[model samples]
Target: MELACAFLARNRMEEYELLRVFFDSKVVREGLSELQIPSPLGRDVGGFQEQWAGPLCLDGILAGLIVNGGAYKRYRGPARDAKVLAGAAVEALTQNRFEDFRVDVSHVAWAPWFANVAWDHTYILTDTANAEITVLCITDTD
Candidate 1:
């Protein structure tokens, strides 16, 4: 896996640390490159801002989508692709019914850092239903 770390939201430090433990584990590290944790979007009951990260694939087949306001430009993809993934992430956060869901972005080939061959994109989303935390992952495949 790449030794790079993406920028995380300062206000969400505690939540980011918890997520870091999971993303940095041996199991998750096997296939993921980098993990990004997004900041809170706005104020609403049960309407917490979406939290997401770009998880680069170890094989260089999956590039991560950059979260808005993130400071890590080195790990960001094209603006168009980023926007699309961001939109999908937001949708996942709003329309999620189950505790976990997957958003498909196979049509997007650009990695957060650079262009790569077309590969299946599956963003794994876990909703804690606490309105305070949500987990997201962008991978090469489901």
Candidate 2:
């Protein structure tokens, strides 16, 4: 439910035509990218720490991030590049706070990956800052 809403919320915001391809639940497929262990650490700078989840869809962004992630094979060129790029827009939308919506927005942890996900006003980022990641999970929403 949370993942679905995250993607839907972004789609509503971007208002792009190609994004419509992801709109249909029937066409949606379960997709998950496994963690690639031994990744270069991201700097928290000043002991940064957080976890945000609930009604957030960071799938598109995540897919692209992992697809191009240096730990794996570089996605070739334009065509594949375009697909990966789509994740960015969705990611941007996830970066906002629903607490400010002034309307009801309910989302839950559901089945967590690594049993954790980060949520703020924008996207749900799984923390890999301190450890190894071998898989990332994406799935068809319920």
Candidate 3:
């Protein structure tokens, strides 16, 4: 896996297809080298974003490496603020009978960091540092 990663970094973008052929079958199905077929424009570019370090190394490697997972980056949040004990509250917050709700966010925190709050109702986040909250409704069940 490390060699595959280094090869990607060392080779030209035009050569990615070659590497795809050598990857595991599961990887191929999950949009590794080729795109799906039989529909609108056939498919889209689905594979590693070369610039993102996380997916690049953690994709096939790091299953049991490092601590739990192989994470190689910097986190600069207050230690306590990063700890989230609000899974139940978060689930309740996005619960919907007619919608498949999901939390498409990270680095999230409630207004009062490390303090107890009714996560089921509301929580403040630093998305964009001073961003507006946007709610999206899904119409598909994939």
Candidate 4:
């Protein structure tokens, strides 16, 4: 619901495309970089940390300040609220199909790898419980 809306809203505002995707739980065993997200991410691996969910919980890399940083502003990215985007991302990563949109992510454990800078908004997020993965990326070469 909201996750789908966030992607749609953001894509409309920017010239660059926002790569958004949801993957099956089985993809986790292949690792973050192998998830088939179509972006020119760095080749290095093992950058992810085991902690509370990043995109879902709206903490760590997905914090409001970082999500709304200069890169997003400079790129004229989504005009949507940061929290709404983050909440939608959580739904994507965890495969939580709640009708209400935002889910309680407080206890959700996630290990996420940020393929690029936080401000660039590129990441590979994994749900520890189901091992499902989701990716969100926006790139501009100007």
Candidate 5:
């Protein structure tokens, strides 16, 4: 949850509460379309799967967010620290449980509030060893 908190902090989403839900990996893998989880478009996991033609690299995602060649470049230190923390969280979550995994990011067009305009990010991490699915969803203004 620290990664979620870091994301919220970075995006200044303190006013809103993030909802974290855990599901059994087996159920998610077997019948994602039938899962009762609330989705942005009322669509199934297949909708998000269609967004990317290939898997997203987690390190690339973190690296791209760093501010470079500007006054904000100095902030890269904190950004690096944040990346380390996020990486630790991911390692802790997937360690010993994953034999193989893939990362994908997708966005949806709906939000709980009228003022919140986007489903800014949805990161799906799938552990292929046993079909475990770990999703980190961030629905905030980017």
Candidate 6:
């Protein structure tokens, strides 16, 4: 995940997109494949889909930071959970104590990659000096 963060820090957007796709595919293939299934008599289990479970506010913050010109890089690191990191970041940002960084005004709430259950925690870091942002995601399995 540090590699991903470096790529984003360098503003290599295309490579970052490719990396994100690769990670997302891996999560879907490996993570979702572990789901338990019970046998049924000639029953077909179709239309299976995985989604990130979270509220809209966090999702919007992530999108604005990454997609809408905020230029946030992602870094995976240790944490208890994503919710905790997000809540802290949100509170700090809301209270004007988030290291002088401001949230983008555009509203968007769909970031499937952030919902990947493979990660347990995520942190967004910003370098005010260089105007760079990094996101750190943590997990025990990896």
State which candidate has the highest lDDT.
5
Q: Residue 62 of model 1: what lDDT?
A: 26
Best by TM-score: 5
lDDT of 3 by residue, 26-83 (tens): 5433542222221222111223222233222221221221122212343354433333
TM-score of each candidate structure, all chains considered together: 0.25, 0.21, 0.21, 0.35, 0.46, 0.25
lDDT of 1 at 20: 43
Quick one: ranking by lDDT, best first?
5, 4, 6, 1, 2, 3
Report every candidate's CA lDDT: 0.35, 0.31, 0.26, 0.38, 0.44, 0.36
Residue-level lDDT of model 5, residues 1-142, one tens digit each, is 4444444434422233222222323444355433344444232332344223223346445443432322223344656675675566667656734335555455653333212333345666655544455666553343
Better of 1 and 5 by TM-score: 5
Once fitted onto the true fold, the runs of candidate 2 whose alpha carbons sit more than 4 angstroms away are: 1-48, 51-67, 70-72, 79-84, 88-142
Compared with the true structure, what per-residue lDDT tens digits does model 4 show for residues 17-122?
2122232223433555533533433322223322343343443335454454654353245535555665665655555632222221211112243234433334
Candidate 1 per-residue lDDT, tens place, 50-111, comes to: 32332222112222335332232344567667556655656546463443322222333322
Q: What tens digits encode model 6's per-residue C-alpha lDDT throughout 1-142?
A: 4454455456553434623342245443364343222222111122111112222255444443333221233434433344456566656544433443322221111233333333333443433334544334433322
Which runs of model 5 end up more than 4 angstroms from their true locations? 1-46, 49-56, 60-77, 96-99, 110-119
In model 3, where do residues sit more than 4 Å from their true spots?
1-3, 18-44, 52-80, 83-142
lDDT of 2: 0.31
**Where does candidate 4 stray beyond 4 Å?**
1-46, 52-56, 59-80, 95-122, 138-142
Could you tell which candidate, 1 or 4, scores higher by lDDT?
4
**Poorly placed runs, candidate 6 (over 4 Å):** 16-19, 25-89, 92-142
- The positional error of residue 67 in candidate 6, measured at the CA in angstroms, is 23
Candidate 2 residues 1-142, lDDT tens each? 3443454345342233222232222323243222221122222211222224332434444455445544335556654554546555434433344232211111223233322332211223321222111112333222
